[model samples]
Target: MDRPALGDLEAFLAIVSHRSFRKAADELGLSPSSLSHMMRALEKRMGVRLINRTTRSVAPTEAGERLAARLGPALSGLDQALETVDAWRGGPSGTLRINTNEHAARRLLKEIVPTFLSRYPDMALDLVSDGRFIDIVADGFDAGIRLRESVPQDMIAVPFGGTTRFLAIASPSYLERRGVPKVPDDLLGHDCIRLRLPSGKLYRWEFEKHGEEVAIDVPGALMLDHIGLMAEAAAGGLGIAYVHELVAAPFLASGALVAVLSDWCPEIDGLCLFYPGHRHVPAGLKAFIELLREHDRRGKLG
Candidate 1:
């Protein structure tokens, strides 16, 4: 049999790697339907079923797995080789995989993404928003953005955001009806809004005062996964929301929510972009780092 075209091989490889046509299509810059059609065409020409597709998941057939086991490393090497050439050429291209949380994604999209995408047309940014502290190397991410405190010490960290704090907030009406808690412990009796972490555990509200720190597992009827929604719930008079001050700022400014226990909110290290220090930095990542630093210097990024 004749060898598959480079594009077809890449399409098949992406599908197998991601285990979802939609996700693979996103990486390959093609619509899922189009990618599906191409896979069909490729399978027809190759005279075998390359992918075993089901509604819930995608996987490679036996022959396809053997092909991928052989081809994956070689294509990766070829890609790395080309990226090295691009480093000398100063035209950063190829995919840049990033793992980050919703907060950082919002900040990047708001402050940096538009300009960065326009400036580096050849570069493809693949941002995955996940709250889990995933192992970037094991998960195949080029880099990860996380709160400085949460970032692994082994990775090289670059400051991407300034120090920020969480605030305990509620609507004026809710506070008026329930009365404001004077201390973190006072939250025990109140209808506090709660947040659930990615690990499926409830987020304990952290507070600090006079060199003493405490965490409270405040009880509440309402719980949410995202900070923005938590703020919105507080604004809607659901309950006291412990969330990032940055996300709650607009609601506070609009008089939709009022902050309390401000003294208890601890100031922590800001968000950091991190990568394994041992590996060679790809040109795309290098370009992004330079751009980020430039923006920070100009006082545009925080």
Candidate 2:
């Protein structure tokens, strides 16, 4: 049998991995129409229908699934081999994809990325903000950011920022209507702004003090998925919000929000940069990690 073209194989793999023509096109730096044509050509060459595409989603046929199961690891190995070769000659000259929460991304970009990009002009950085915990390897991310305590035990976690604490805050007007809580349980009587997790459950508010940890399921009139939106709702006097102190600092200083339960707010391990343990760190990730360390040393990360 004649060998399949490398481009066709790559396009096929990308489409199978992302399950979206537009997303695969963006990742491969190809136009959507071009990627579609490439897939059609590959399917014709293989003499089998590979993908089942509907208006809402895409999936692989049984034959395509078998091919993907065999090709996925081979393609991953090829990518690792290329990365290993690039590492030898590198002063950080490739794209680095990272998944993180919005707060962590904002903090890292403020102190680390600007200088690193200036030094390595050829390097590209792609940061995606996601609230849910994700498998970085499955998602094709080089690294991900999460709290130190949240990182998996098998992953290598490096501290990226200083300690953080949660603050219970409310607008003055709301506080006037419903008095401040003296303790965690008092939140049960208040109109709290609850955060909804990606898994479709309310986030439990956590607090620590004097070696005692508490998780409270507070009542609320509003529920939101995004932290920024929750903050905005709190600012609008909708309800009290439990959020990171750093996130509410500006509002607190400006008197738009007033923090309560300060004594219960406890310092906890900060954000961490974590990645798969088995995979070799790419030069781009190494450079970014070093940049973070340097920034930490200088006390620039807050």
Candidate 3:
């Protein structure tokens, strides 16, 4: 029997992983029609249908499922072997893709990234800032930065930065007009700047004090999606905003904003670098982890 082309196998895997011809095509940098043709050719060569397509979705057939199960490990092993070879090239090299929130990215850049980049000039860094949680392995990311609470238990989580606190802040003018909320319950009576999530829903303000946690549904005159935008609005006297203390520090120091319910604010575990435990981590990722650890040890992470 003639062996299938590597392109055909890759196309098949992409289609199965994406579950959509359009998505797979987009990922592979090929037109949808071309991807479809390739899949058809692959199926013909194998003498069996590998995918079941419908108007709304696509899925692997029984034979396709079996092939995927076998192919997944083989492909993973190939990638690992290649990475091991690449690691032996000496200094860390290769693009390191990191998924993180804007706040975490900012914090990391403030102290950790500069020296790391200077030390490993050959390594390229790709930082993607997104609010929603993502699967690093499935999304093809080298690692992800998120709050410790948000990280999954299966992943190895290393503290990337020190503890951080959340603050409820408002412009002095807004507070003078609307009055500051002394307690979490007082937030109900004030106009707050609300955050809209990527899922198109408002984020409820969360608070903790004396070991009691509370989620507050505060009324807002304006709703914004980005945390930076929400901070800007609060600074502009729009309303009270729930934001990370680090992001609000400058404004607080400049007297542009005033903190409310300060006694209730609690310090939580800061950003953590997490990755899948099941796979062999790339040398680039391993190097990054070491940098973070060294930064923490030297008290360089601020």
lDDT of all predictions, in order shown? 0.87, 0.85, 0.85
Clashing pairs in 1: 161-302
Report lDDT (Cα) of residue 156, candidate 2.
91
For candidate 3, lDDT tens digit of each residue in 201-266? 888888888899889989988998887888889999988999888788999999998898988888
Q: Could you say which candidate leads in TM-score? A: 3
Best candidate according to lDDT: 1
Q: Candidate 2 residues 229-292, lDDT tens each?
A: 7777898999889888878988899999998999999888999999987666777898898989
Better of 1 and 2 by TM-score: 2
Better of 1 and 2 by lDDT: 1
Compared with the true structure, what per-residue lDDT tens digits does model 1 show for residues 68-159?
89887788788678777774665888788999988889889986788778888888998999778898765668899988989998999999
Better of 2 and 3 by TM-score: 3
All predictions: root-mean-square deviation over Cα? 5.2, 4.1, 2.5
When summed lDDT is taken over every stretch of 10 residues in candidate 2, the lowest stretch is 83-92
In model 2, how large is the Cα lDDT of residue 47? 86
